[model samples]
Target: MGYSPSVHKFAEGADVPVPLDLELVRAVLEPHDVGDPRLCFDPDGDLQFWIRAGDGSEAEIFAGDTGILVERPHSGGVFGIVAELVSRLGAVAVDPSEGRIVCSTEEYAHLPVSMRKDAVVIEMTGERLEAALLGRRPA
Candidate 1:
């Protein structure tokens, strides 16, 4: 719903603030067409949150203690929302498919072609890291 169809934040996991500030993300997103965010879970029940877009569909913004993963197919005039979030959150826009961290849409026309394919692995890796930090088992 933004410049890129899919964007992975916290490309560099070590750089995030410990006890990640959930409010910081809320603040950055509140001004947009999205509504309030609330705790959400998949059928598998991995912890995350969801924000409802104006269209009443869930926005792809996935918030975790360590990173945020967003993947969307439709464009709802939410352009540049991702850029602002990245800027305000100090989160890196990593396109592993491109083998680089993308800072702006101008850097390339294609942001990620393989992220959807690789997200499960990347997220699983993050789960281990998060589990270590929280002193808990990864679900």
Candidate 2:
């Protein structure tokens, strides 16, 4: 994981092609290192994914492994902002050549977007998003 943007893909709730600012994503994620395997679980069990990173590591995100997942303790605006960013990023990174891409819930909807796909909510809240990616499992 030598910070190759072209080596990544994004998939959201749509089938259309979308361009992403890899630099932006990198800026958001570059501060952390790849570590743990995070999980997202939707009520309907329709969507799932994880992010792996660690201290001083680049974050790697993945989706579509669980049901319609939603993280808790989030308000409408925050959720929307995060969903927008994640879905936008996902849409860009998802490879149509491999399979289908879905957004599931629209931005601002009740969709869950983990700060880091690999770590637990505690780790995310504790500012350990980067540590989790470095293969550090949450206690």
Candidate 3:
């Protein structure tokens, strides 16, 4: 099934906090005519689709397989847990913001020289990643 009409309507040239819907991602990239049908993982171990269009262009889109991975920025302890989880899942942690988990097959390819305080920039697309930073721990 495709994304709800409301979801498409909401996504129309807008950025919002919506769980990664597999169907919607497929529909959104089909028009692009990218590559062959393939599945990949994001930074969070969530499933994603890789479409190989006619022109051989490739598009990577998130599939909402995994539910809300991390609501807020993860702390050292929590972050370690996530890391371990990904490792066990046979994936790697990409970004905490999007909760991008990817397989070893998918290399980082590139990464920013440094992530800014409270800001993450996707090295590939050069887009700023926004996610709530891990909150302070109580004394």
Number of the top TM-score candidate = 1
39, model 2: CA deviation in Å?
29
Model 1 agreement with the true structure over 1-139: per-residue lDDT tens digits:
2422333344323333233456776676555434333444444433344444454444466665656666541333232455556556544455433434544333222234433332322222333322322234666
For model 3 the TM-score comes to 0.24
Q: Can you give the TM-score per candidate against the true fold?
A: 0.44, 0.26, 0.24
List, residue by residue over 29-139, the lDDT tens digit for candidate 3.
445423344434556665544433343433333435433233332122333333333333332234443433232222222212131232222211101111212222222
Alpha-carbon RMSD of each model? 13.5, 15.0, 15.9
Model 2: per-residue lDDT, tens digit, 4-98?
11112223423223344545543443333133323333464322333223222222332232211222212222222233435445422111222
Number of the top-ranking candidate, with lDDT as the measure: 1
TM-score head-to-head 2 vs 3, winner = 2
Poorest 10 consecutive residues by lDDT, candidate 3: 3-12
Better of 1 and 3 by TM-score: 1
